[model samples]
Target chain A: MATTNDYLKGTKSVLPILTGLFPFGLIYGVSAVTSGIPKVQAIAMSFVVFAGAAQISIVNSFSSGISIITAVAIAGLINLRMAMYGASIADSIRSDRLLTRIFSSFLLTDQVYAVSITEKGKNMNTNIFKFYIGAALPIWLTWQAATIIGVFAGKTLPSWLSLEFAVPLTFLALLGPFLVKSHFAVSALTAGIVMVLTRNVPYNAGFFIAVLSGITAGFLIKNRKGDR
Target chain B: MNTSHLWAVIILSGIATFIIRFFFIQIKQAPLSGKVKELFSFIPPAVLSALVFGSVFENGLSSLTPRNPYLWASILAGITAVTSKNVLLTISTGMIFIWGWNYLY
Candidate 1:
């Protein structure tokens, strides 16, 4: 049976991620509304696409009068990391049922993936899939609600708050725990350097470049550390 | 965009996203060398860092100068992240700093 400590621990892990996600939800709602997408369509996309970055990309591209094909392409490219995330969780869960696997795939996101991986590594006996769902479902629901709130009330909210910064802040919080080690530190630095160097690449392809470069750097550092 | 075009975008994005996800999962059978595994591990931090920097900075084309309070706030946030090991504190402090700076300046 789950004890009070278990509940407390779960709440501790889940709340921060939800808080971080709140700003992005608000941004999506406001942006979608401002971009001329009907409220229902905007709300629907949040559930259907179920990705913050892709939704933002779609809205931004549409607002700029870019072709839908190009917009979708850009959004897809931005969210390619979800594939890695899905695969990572799939390996961990190792569920035989295809339906369970497919349903679980819908819950994969950056925050969910990071939290799940860390939790899986920490708790060997715990049910990894359940933990992932526990972490992910709240995030997904919170995102939808936040978007709707933003859509309806974003304009009424003061500009002084500048809810846009909330996304970066959330990511900062998510990434904070992972940087406890040197390998992670160097890798993050390398990624930042590469991203800055390739920042001008069109369609945000630079994000991919930064990810690849950082991964390569991290591998090298880890190997060198292992050798020592 | 028109309705047909929007549907096309959604369809294309869904397909592309599925393919990218499937690519990683399909590779589970392949044996990764130790060195390669080590290298791939860095991808998350590197990719995330780059994206973070890109988000904080404007125009994606400019160099990092300390002209903006956002950068200052981020530095403070980074420091807080390293010291306290608390995500909430780091983010809240960073946001407050940025908000206050924007308010004052």
Candidate 2:
């Protein structure tokens, strides 16, 4: 059972990540609106798909002459790792209720994973379901509101704002605290270099490739240390 | 191509994604093995770095040249991220730098 304090703490902890998503949400809305799709259909994606990277992938797919099946496939592949996230954190929740698990799964996201997983490690007794909801609801609402604003004011926003940079900056901030260990540094550097080298690969296959190789590289090195 | 196709894509992808999210939570298998769990620990950093570098260099390595305001802002943002370790500060500072630099240059 989650206390009111747990919910408030979760909300407070996620505010920074929500700040980072604000600009990216605006960009998604603007890009989807102008990406040759009808505006209402584009905005509806925020409600249905609710994954920023997948939404961007689908929009790019549409613009590139791909079939809808192909677009869905690409987006699904980009999100395949969410399965890993769900599996990794499955142990944290104490609830056995089917509805609770289903509801919590719906809110599973990169930011929620980052905050909840880290918080889970620090203290084991907290009600993760409530914490997840607190974090997820605010970010979900922000994304919807920002998309609407982006769709309407897409033309009014200045390119000089460099809003696109926020996405990368957000990733960096999430990564910084984890870099103290050489294993983590090795993984991040390998992933980054691989992503750059394979940027030209079509359908963003490079992303999956980089993810696999980078994780393998770090996993191998960490195991090597364990062998000694 | 058509409106139906677009809707199909949205609905299918959403269902596929939710299924993935739901898979492990529903399965009542033995807990993940130790080695597998160790590998999972590396994923967050690996995935986050791949995403950051992918966006920063989306236009290819040539775009990282000093002429690109984003490159400079990224460098400064990286420093702030490491030093401050604060999300809101890192993003706000990076954008402010990019906006100021773009205006002046």
Candidate 3:
């Protein structure tokens, strides 16, 4: 069972991450509306889809020449790693009831998973499921509120805001942490260059190519270092 | 796509994503080797870089020019992210620079 302290700790731990999400959510809301996604659905997608990167990219896939199947594939591919997080934390919740697992799985996300996994290392026998919930619920609420606000605030904002830069900047912030790791750095560089070169590929196949090449480069580099 | 079609896309894709999240958690046997599991770890960085690079350099060589404050904003953002390691700090730095650049020039 999760005590009040654990839940509070989870909430307090997530405060910094919450501040970061506000802009991303606002940007997603603003962008999704203009990307041919209906305003209402855009708000709905926040809580429904709940994955920011996948949600933004899926909305991008809606452009002409990209098939619906392709859109669906993009969503699946982007989120495949969620299962990895699911598996990583599975040991902690092995004995929980099905309903508990289902609810927990619904809220599983990168930030929540990161906090829960890090906490796991510090304390044994912690109720991670409750911690996960405490962390996830606030994120969910913040995202939805921001997205809704963005949807309504769409187009009314000043033209000088350059809202277009918000997403990339946010992503850059996320990618920045991995730069110190040689293998990860090389992987990011490989993907970045590949993406730029393949930008014009039909149906945005560049995304798949870039990601694959990055992972391959990172894996190979890591393997070589291990062998030597 | 019509509203209905878009709705279908949203609901279907949402379901597919949820299934992926639920698969390993719901099942008892979500086994993997050390090597394969490590590969999964590379996914986020790779994906984040792809998205960021593709967006920042969206216009190919055109975006590399000095007028593109996004490029500059990204540099500041990258530095803030690594040094501060605070997501909010990095975002604020980037947002402030890009927005400020827009008005100043």
Please report the candidate that would top DockQ against the real structure.
3
In order of DockQ, best first, we have 3, 2, 1
Compose the digit string of candidate 1's lDDT tens values, residues A1-228.
343343234435788778767876876787677666778777877877888767766665565555766677657756766765665566775467766666667667788778878877887765666777677778878999998998897556666776556555555654666688887887788777777787777766776678777777776777777853
User: Tens digits of per-residue lDDT for model 2 on A4-35?
Assistant: 57777779889988887887788678766665
* lDDT accuracy of residue B84 in candidate 3: 81
Among all candidates shown, the one with the greatest lDDT: 3
lDDT of each: 0.69, 0.77, 0.81
Per-residue lDDT over B1-105 for candidate 3, one digit per residue giving the tens place of the 0 to 100 score: 566767777888899888988888988877967888788878878888888887788776567788877788888898998888776688779989987887788
Which stretches of candidate 2 lie above 4 Å from their native place?
A1-42, A52-85, A88-100, A110-139, A201-203, B1-9
Clash-forming residue pairs, model 2: none
Instruction: Give the worst 10-residue stretch by lDDT in candidate 1 chain A.
Output: A1-10
TM-score of chain B of each: 0.65, 0.74, 0.87
True contacts recovered per prediction:
0.53, 0.70, 0.66
Docking class of 2: medium
The regions of model 1 sitting more than 4 angstroms off are: A1-42, A52-97, A109-139, A201-205, B1-13, B16-39, B59-63, B84-88
The most accurate candidate by TM-score is 3
Model 2 backbone overlap count: 0
In terms of TM-score, how similar is model 2 to the real structure? 0.72
For A138-162, candidate 3 gives per-residue lDDT tens digits of 9888999999988888667665776
